[model samples]
Target: MSQYGAKYKYGKASPSDGFDCSGLIFWAYGKHGITVPRHTAAQSKAGKWVAARNARQGDIVVFRIGRRLHTGLVADKGRFLHAPSSGGYVRMESLSGVYWKNKIVGYRRIV
Candidate 1:
């Protein structure tokens, strides 16, 4: 939660520096001693796949943007937390938006 509003820095995964999409996942889980893969693709396959309806809070949410993948942690009903892109800040975004809704790949639970 502390990362909210932090600057987005590609290839970083810490509150002091900033975070990218998957970087937030890496740091958030690491704070609890969980070892999650450090990149979007690997992290997307890091845990048991769960249907969207069954996906609980904290599940890894994956979405395909063009040929690349993006990731974030599931938030409220239709939102997810992430550091969107360079120059963007960490924040919660609606998953139901036309762009995001169309890009969803799946959800995964690390625990």
Candidate 2:
């Protein structure tokens, strides 16, 4: 997913081009033949809920940024991969960071 960084677009989900937060997740799971929703709100309810402390790789990390929802895929126990804002790139970030910790709403297991 590193190849998708820096050039991310807000609504497109193409790996050769760019992606939004939910679009990135949708594309990643689609490559594995798993179908998921196209919006963060729908995606948030697509999988079973899991506690953040028990989150594992592949779990969906949901966050509430002001009045908007954001999502990322768990990369490990304490990190997640996501396509950030329109000007940001797809990157792995630590969940323990103050910014994420305070924004995190919950975790979900898509599989």
Candidate 3:
């Protein structure tokens, strides 16, 4: 994850270039030979649902932002790594932050 910090690009999945939200997830999992769907909606349903209280590192966190879905990789109990937006790069952020907390839908464990 350190290799990807501050690197972001819309609709790109390459680490050498950058990544979007789901693309980041796709790249990280692919590094471990785990394959996941490319879209956030499909990704939200790809793994078994885990209650937020049980979330651990590597768990996929899903969020509902207006009519679209967003995703992040849980880095710890209270933080996650994500490629925030067009102008933002991949970064670690607090899940408990008011903005993220209110948008969270659930967490999924792929492994």
Q: lDDT by residue for model 1 over 1-111, one digit each (tens)?
A: 678899999999998999999999999999999999999999989999999899778999999999999999998779989999988999988989877998999999999
- Cα lDDT for residue 28, candidate 2: 85
| Best-to-worst ranking by lDDT | 1, 3, 2
Model 1 alpha-carbon miss at residue 70, Å: 0.3
| Candidate 3, poorest ten consecutive residues by summed lDDT | 1-10
What is candidate 3's lDDT per residue for 32-102, written digit by digit as tens?
A: 99999998889999989999999999999999999999999999879999998997889999998989999
Candidate 1 at residue 44, lDDT? 89
Instruction: Give the runs in model 1 whose Cα sits over 4 Å from its true position.
Output: none
Each candidate: what lDDT?
0.93, 0.87, 0.91
lDDT by residue for model 2 (58-79), tens: 8889999999999999988798
Kindly state the number of residue pairs that clash in model 2.
0
Better of 2 and 3 by lDDT: 3
**Candidates 1 and 2, the one with greater lDDT:** 1
Clashes of each: 0, 0, 0
TM-score of each: 0.97, 0.93, 0.95
